[model samples]
Target: MQNFGLCLVIKQELKPIPLQNVVVEANIVDMIAEVTISQIYKNIEKDTIEALYKFPIYEAAAICEFEAEIGGQRKVKGIVKESKEAAKEYTEEVQKGHGAYLLESESKDIFQCSVGNITSGQTVVIKITYVTELNHDSESENIRFVLPTNIAPRYGSSEYSSSSNEGKILNPDVVSYSSKANYYLDLTVTCRMTSTIQNIESPSHKISTEMNIDENPKISKITLTEQITYLEKIFILVVKSKDLDQPRAFVEYNPETQTNCIISYNKKTFIYTALTSQEILTIQQVARVKSTNISTNTWINTLEAFRHDLQLPGKIEDIDTKEELECQLVLFFVSCKQQNGKDYSVQSIKTARFAIACHINLYSKIRPQDINNKNVYPDLYNAITGKIKILTKSGFGESRGADAFTESEIQLIVNHPAMQTDSPKGLLRRIFWHNAFEFALRGGEHYDLKIQHFVKRKDGGIDVIFYQSKCNQIRLSNSNPKSEIISISPNENIIKDYELYFTKRPPQCDDAFYLQSCNQAEVEFTGYWYKSAHVGRNSLNKFMNEIALVTGINCDDRKFSNHSGRKTFVQYSKSRGISDNDVMSVSRHKNPHSLSYYERPKTVLQQNTLTQINDIIYKKRVVTNEAKNQSTSFTAALEFYKGSISENCKFKALAYLNYHIAYYIIENNISPLPLSEKPRVPFQEIKDSQNIQLDEDCIKKFLQGNTFNNCNITFNMNQ
Candidate 1:
């Protein structure tokens, strides 16, 4: 009843306020921090063994099952149009790599010669009963051919293969076979071959870093009166000497251990002391003591005794008098408070005193050798050293700093490779952007942000703050709190050649077409763009185009849209892993998934690939002992092992079955020690069977809500 009355009284006193989304005029201070990044993409290569070994000069070549477009001189009636095109395309392709050359490039004659054909013969009558259109759902086309000739050709494995086989070329335009007239051979045969479209991509990236969040930002209540508990008023004779040649002098007021009490030499005696670890109290822990200083000394309590550790100290400079030493010992006490919510806290208090002079080391220059506080990680040195500090009194963790080039650079880069493109402005933005992004990306997915931003930092640079969102609705997916900012330049270095290459102008807009025109484009920070050499920032326009292309989002203007992709991508990626914060800092968010968004589709080719895999695996789920004699990647061992799955593959049963076989072989065989990674087949790779007809009664029954596993039967556990 008392609680009820109290709640009723509180309800009358509490008042609610409405929030107005007003356009408050406030400048957003940004602290720019920078890190230089150099990205170099290298191409990896794989070896291939061609099949001309079976077929001699007149030997039967490839047996393919792909479509052939027949574009003959005339309309070859029964032959399909694709068949004719395939014939012509094959002929042209075979003629490409048929000549014999010397093996050495330096040879007067031909150093190397091309002798075999990938496509050796053509049907007198083209009959491509099976034709397949190029599918954009997969990485490559699905098609296979036979190399029957037994002739061995010299193989040069290079990412760039200059030597082309003379057989039919299976290019994007056409799949064909080329055959020379065999005077003695006139056998009628159709190469019944198989093929498939396979995908090749790099693996996902993996990285980790030291943790940042800790209680060091909490407030302490230490007091000034409670400062040095043992203040001394020992009476002693005073003396001073101005001459550098003459030594300073002093005498101890009372008898004490000679070493601990004073330093006497050349008529000068010096006294030095600090609150011993036990003598000093933090207001919260004053009752915990077990030392002799607490009992014996009365007038001016002796300094507290603490732990013993030693370092060879740099000798104190020569002081002319005891007064000079007295001038150096002035001390101060500091403290703060936390309201309620938190259960624990840590501080970044100023812990040491030293005169600022050439001989004195500032916290900034205090080398690691001078530090004994190893509990703090190397990264927190600046924080502990007071080079940087936390100030949250006004609420949302704001920081400031003052020569601000580093801050500017950080901002410039942040806006890039995302907003600005690699262009000058974008480049600068990226340099700074990295710092803020790097900090946020580290928060991980479980983070719940309130407000995080970066503005002017102490270096006359940028400062960053991160917090949980205050928005009521889920406008954005980011939920992490505890963010950071920095100060620095955005670009690693300036690259002006891109601008000059396009002649000093942004491209002019085609008033009639509303499109920007760049006939002679130049590649700059913003990327490759060509505008009227006399007009605008061509690079900016190109950046816009790339942004739209890479992302489906449209920008209001080309420049605006072009530059915002990187920034916006941050939002999207933050939603993906939450823990991907660190990776995002490096601008490496879209790799493995990029393949999924851009894929090809062609069924026959896919079937051919499956067929090849099946053949390689033999009749068992696992590669049999027979398959072991094949090859390593395509090993007798791998016979049970089907090839790897695509990078962004979603899981399913067909893929499961294929990989299951491979798994069994590894589990039971002696080819290797570890199990192979199971394949992940993409449900996205499969085209929707929208056109399939269904019985009306059956459809009605299904629509009435029969139990089904999400309607993707291929995903059914049992094939």
Candidate 2:
């Protein structure tokens, strides 16, 4: 087997730069601003290349329009649709070698734009328009407008990027920070104020201001003095006006929707009101829509129904009393239904309640603090806690975590015909299963494992080291305290499987540990089991399920996913009386409470415990001679092996002996071998029958003067 010690060497390459220029134009009126950002991309490479740009937007901003001009001729406008549908369309266009543009929201503040199939020397311009409210100082008459330019690296996995359409939207090329783009940013802002403008300045950059006071004293324009600036920092401009302390109200009529919206601002408090020809309603009431797809939009629909019943707007300012809020929540929880028009399950209801609590907490943070009390939503906060007791009593919360595999199920899986086969796929399955169960690896963690992570130890065991995982992404210090190292004892069967698999692995394959298998005919002819392609993520995730199906196990009643291996390891270790800290060392769990979630007992173990308790209570406890003998014999064997085996071959000899002893007991349907004063060959039958090879001198030395029950048996050495 090839030895890959610790680190992997990655070749450094020059990253590509496709973004050329960015221009921003903004028009501000009082507290609201409408901005347009234009990004230009050019393909300077000889062949066609896709350009992907990730940028930041204000969290509260609402994107209004997106348009693109490909090669400065063809104009394409973006349409709002479901994410999956839009991704499908973009993929189809890219597959046809045609120009396509896609703008998607990665998070509340992060956005990604892709220009696909940009031919050589082609220039594409993308424009995005959005409207946002200016940040106003509570104590001063100044309003601040901010335009985000740089998107900082985020830590967790993106919820949007983890969907089914991830492959189509997420490009690894866009994630590189080494690329330096030859680009310039130009920004122009035109501000219109209701009161007289006192001053306009930028604290972040040098800016030039122009006032058309002669034509209209309320209008002012601001621009960057340098004209050429890099997109490295946020652009902020503060506008101070006189006599801005008075309350103000503005109404805008939308002819398209035939509705009038009134915005009232007074002392940092804003109230939105909607007016129609028939009656006046709150903004939430007017925006409410009866959604037909209840499954995906249950949270929103439930909130809308609650507000409609009480004639309350979505804003926290519209809510008056604690009693009213509690009543509204009670109504929502009782009336909410699933997609099939049935009441939600206990878990689903709990999830919905969590979503509502998150909304309340968010509003409390953003709402202005009162002079009398610092807590903004005391009533609402109290309501959330008060309802929990009632909800729990109604059986609204229950946890149904992933199920662990039983001992019999594990035996069936490892001894299945597919696992024992000599084909390439079979070998891959064996390695995958063993690694997952032994190391307690999470599902997605297997996707990034490389050949370099495995290191051979001096004790003849293998140590699998993990440098990074989902729980530990950022390493703050030089010490690798968080890295998990799992040691595999030197077992004959396991070592042989690994050696054969490595020998048959294709040389063209990269450093990825897992590879997809080639056809059986190709493997037979070329002696290569796997091709150059790495295994697909979906295949790795469903590997355990495939094994269950082949073993004729029903998966409908219980979940047997890739996570089952991890759960099984935890449960099995606990059954063997392993300490929590010892298990945590192998599992690499930082929290003891998190480890408890995987410690569910199997039905058989639960029944055995109950029976033991009953026997003790009834004074019918009977300790069998076979049980005592089995325990004593195993303990004595362990001590004997520890004292007799040589330092160089201790691990291998002990593992081989233990495996054969278990096999002997199971084959003969008898009790464990007992230690005796006379010599005997406990594994003589296995030694003569099995075709496995081992060191002859080491075996002879170990059995030369060993005593076992006075039954002497001949030993055969096979090469």
Candidate 3:
């Protein structure tokens, strides 16, 4: 009875400030998904407090909506404003002691929320909504959705000079993951698609799925099996659909105008998406306007000519046999302003055609009609023995700028003992490495060449084939003839080295370059070739490092990879003051932008123009002093001195002029070098001038001024 009476006066305290709950709901469409997150923050402490929460989502997500509720009753919609204004408003509201909340972006994938002025026994709820595109892997046709949870503490300067959209990234709530509050998350997902769902799964979180229909699934729902306690890892889900392996087209028709259009291919092929409809119409309109001077047919012919001049890879053959279907396909592509949803240069198309022909024979179902009607334009004469062939060499990594080979480094490698004693392999390696450095050949291009691709010019030079790389094919054209190489070898016997390597060259294979054994009996070495460009690159780097160590050179700081050869060429050209355009010609870089990557930054002392400017400025400052305490200016004094000098002593006069300039530089503190602090002049040579007169007093007057206050200066004549 006493306890019951005491309960009548009990006070209601606030909750212990834990994140009471979290709810994540997602609605996924064909290529886009919209997500909403609800978080409940209850202040369990007896005193009023503010809560700060930092979280992460998908990088591409666009946050479009935010709202907050106080004490489960009062709700206010969030207004989007400029980052600074929003921050200011939030601060003002919080200071007034009104319950206020602010949500802001920290990075592409991260965000922060601050809720202020929660009274005792009060709870706050924050609701955030965002949308993001679902990533689809074209090669696999699998849809991936990732909800990031791991938000690493970003390291950067805390001070921001100005306010911008990125200003929110500097929020105080953006603390390190270790210091973040313990939070629980609950996730649910709903996805609908026109295509049949084959598999739905999560790689980062344990989840359960429910389908609307057991068979021929189209709609599905997924949920995490348990609430996540750690926001330190990601939640990933993948949805794979059936018929994804088959090439499919999406056709939408507008009944209002009876207009039908093909939008895309499995949302992966980008050919039609490369150009906008308006842009395509503009091109056609320009062509139409030009056709007024000629016939419409003539304009069409002109377009065909322009396309032909581009040296596009495929051929225009008799699609007339299946005329209607082919016409429709071509019109569809033209209207879409895309070929295969990708822009393929003339060269890549030929490569693709050649590749197709090479494998056409592998299929048993291939028919005469199929061969004749197939889109392989200019038919391959014979893939194996043809002049034009698609050669395949594999490599995956891009060239990362490593080290530039110095002239001394190249010479050291050229003279390594292994080049002479290690038989055919060593000799071959030496020649290959030298030529690669001089010519700046990319690893893949060099590895792909064959003997036929190299021509021994009559003028004791070599001509090698070069391909402007493309995705599908090695496109060939008469315009892309062999690049001529003038011999710039270190050794005088480079021609002899090349001749010897050719003599020891392994028996001919489809590939131009092959590895041969020093001993002819080694069958395994007879036709050894690199499987990929990466393998050859690694081998060359290893060989160079080994040689460098043997030569007592430090290779630790430098990365002597295959790209080093290219970088070395650029560096050498720059040192010789070669123009960027001229360097691009030898490097075959399509533009100056691509060439800039190879250009190294210049050192302060290497700036010759700046050095010249400094010399001129300091010389003028020294000359300025001559104008003071003298009847004539420095220029007038120089003129008088030059007139007094005899013809034979003219060289000495120039020396005297330079000496005075140096002396002035020392007096004015212009030169930092201690040796430059004094004037350099030969006094005996000046005295020996027979045509001129000079004495110790005259010399002293010229250098340090006369002792007399107002003496008219005169040269002492030799009488």
Candidate 4:
């Protein structure tokens, strides 16, 4: 059964702000990230999602003032706010050929120079972008608002970008745009800025909306990260058998809570608590936004520089985007726990790196002239370009249950022709292949096979001890990297070790059935018909694409696709808000290290997560209060808590309309975003600007009378 739901990003956007002296400051309040809550939760259950938010807190304190440069240029001189006082110095893990960058909605995943400069009085239009790890869709399809809403909040367009107050632009190609409003904060006001603004938008299929301004700090640019939790949902912990001293095995949960901590089959009891201290350390270190390791940056930087070159007056629009791009693979560990309280780990595969590789693969064979002339991009072209190679051992262990992978699988990836080749595709492919072994671990039954350390005899099959990053370097003082812990290799030893624990089941005969899904990419890859890799993305992706087309499933178009699998598992864990140690036990990743990646700006989805956490705290309390009763298990308290949230927790918005649309875009796709509104938002001057009657036709089509307040505004979309 596909008990887990797909987490595809239906929409997204990205607004790049070049670090220029004059335009150093950025804001998010009046930007696209700002919107009314109703549009955000229009169709989804409010309790099921959480968000990872990152917004820059300008070094306001450091800004003494702005100064003019030698050429009469102006720039701001200031230090950013000091790093979080609570943040400890964390040494970045050494990883080659792996990093992160935002994929643009209109622009492909390829990062390129987007915005430039002008004078302070010129108005710049911005866009928003989001990177989603949810359900799959076509590669880089632009979702323009069927009707342009470039105006401010007050006056109405055919629709707001699904939320928020925006204006209408009958012609999209027009550059120097103007708005109706004059002031903005909670509202978009008209002003002018100098330069081409980087626009970022949400990827959700938006419904027309109108924004109402309220009192508060407005948002502009935002940085997001997904918070993964609650991986222990399918089962609970118990002992192996009834014997006082016997080998323990992980089992599934039974509703009843027994008096003894031991399992019905075995009497062995675990010594650790549900959540380990190692797990409580929420974040390891806050990293620089979109920073990349050297090896991985080669392609990324090259792509960045190349994109910059493309914006020239004579710049060709049809340049081979895939050839000029760079990509890498990275892996992070995850945690997992079985019914018997035994901890295990496994590897998850990543497909994001592959996506990057696919793009780069497209570029290798493209000659400058061919790129200039050809409209069709092929896959096999990557086998030709001559480029250097770099490899990254980005072993991430943020989740506990995702640690038991062997190197053989990694070797398979590392040795691919593309990986070993000097071409861009080769370098990209090699990184892709090498990173595969890290996230190869699957959940459920596959995780059961990773139980290497028997309770009776402590044995670590392959050791993976993590050292926390302190002061920017991994403090390996107490950890050993040489230990042989469980790995993802299909070598005889791993297969045997796995077979010793979990039995192989017959393949599911269902049409959509798949097996051993860790990153949860178990769907088909190829389209309806088999196709050759005339424009190959290496044998691996070509083969996968074929399957995807046939199965209507998709493989990740990004590198570190394996790691994404483990990340998905962690997201599942966060959904349940399972105890840290439980997360570690199931993921097999150590606790302290596991907590680093998930700590981010909390979103609406986390409301439910905290609700679960509150349930945990309550259960802990009940365990203490009812100790005298001796009739109920500690779990009874938890059951009571789960019941309360299930029955009583009301689905609501955090900040009504302004942020309600956030959840939709982050999980969907990306669009453009603006920093500050110049010339004000359209609706702020609704009474004076356009005739409200102009929008009558489209207004009826959008709302269809879903739930209209007295305002009852109308629109036709065409101004």
In model 3, what lDDT does residue 5 have? 4
Query: Best by TM-score, which number?
Result: 2
Residue-by-residue lDDT tens digits, candidate 4, 573-605: 554557777555535565547655643335745
Decreasing lDDT order of the candidates = 2, 3, 4, 1
User: Model 3: runs farther than 4 Å from truth?
Assistant: 1-16, 149-185, 213-216, 226-233, 242-719
Candidate 3 versus the native: TM-score? 0.31
Candidate 2 residue lDDT tens string, 449-512: 9988988778777888897775665444536546767888888777777777778888778788
lDDT, each prediction: 0.26, 0.66, 0.54, 0.27
Model 2 misplaced regions, further than 4 Å: 1-396, 456-461, 475-482, 508-512, 521-527, 554-556, 591-594, 600-719
lDDT (Cα) of model 3: 0.54
Ranking by TM-score: 2, 3, 4, 1
User: What TM value does model 4 have?
Assistant: 0.18
lDDT of residue 555 for candidate 3: 74
Worst lDDT 10-window in candidate 2: 1-10
Ranking 1 against 4 by TM-score, winner: 4
Local error of candidate 3 at residue 670 (angstroms)? 99
Q: Write the per-residue lDDT of candidate 1 for residues 514-620, one digit (tens) a residue.
A: 11333333444434343432222344334434433333433343333232334434443443444454433343333545323212235645775575467557854
lDDT score at residue 380, model 1, on the 0-100 scale: 32
Instruction: Report the poorest 10 consecutive residues by lDDT, candidate 4.
Output: 34-43
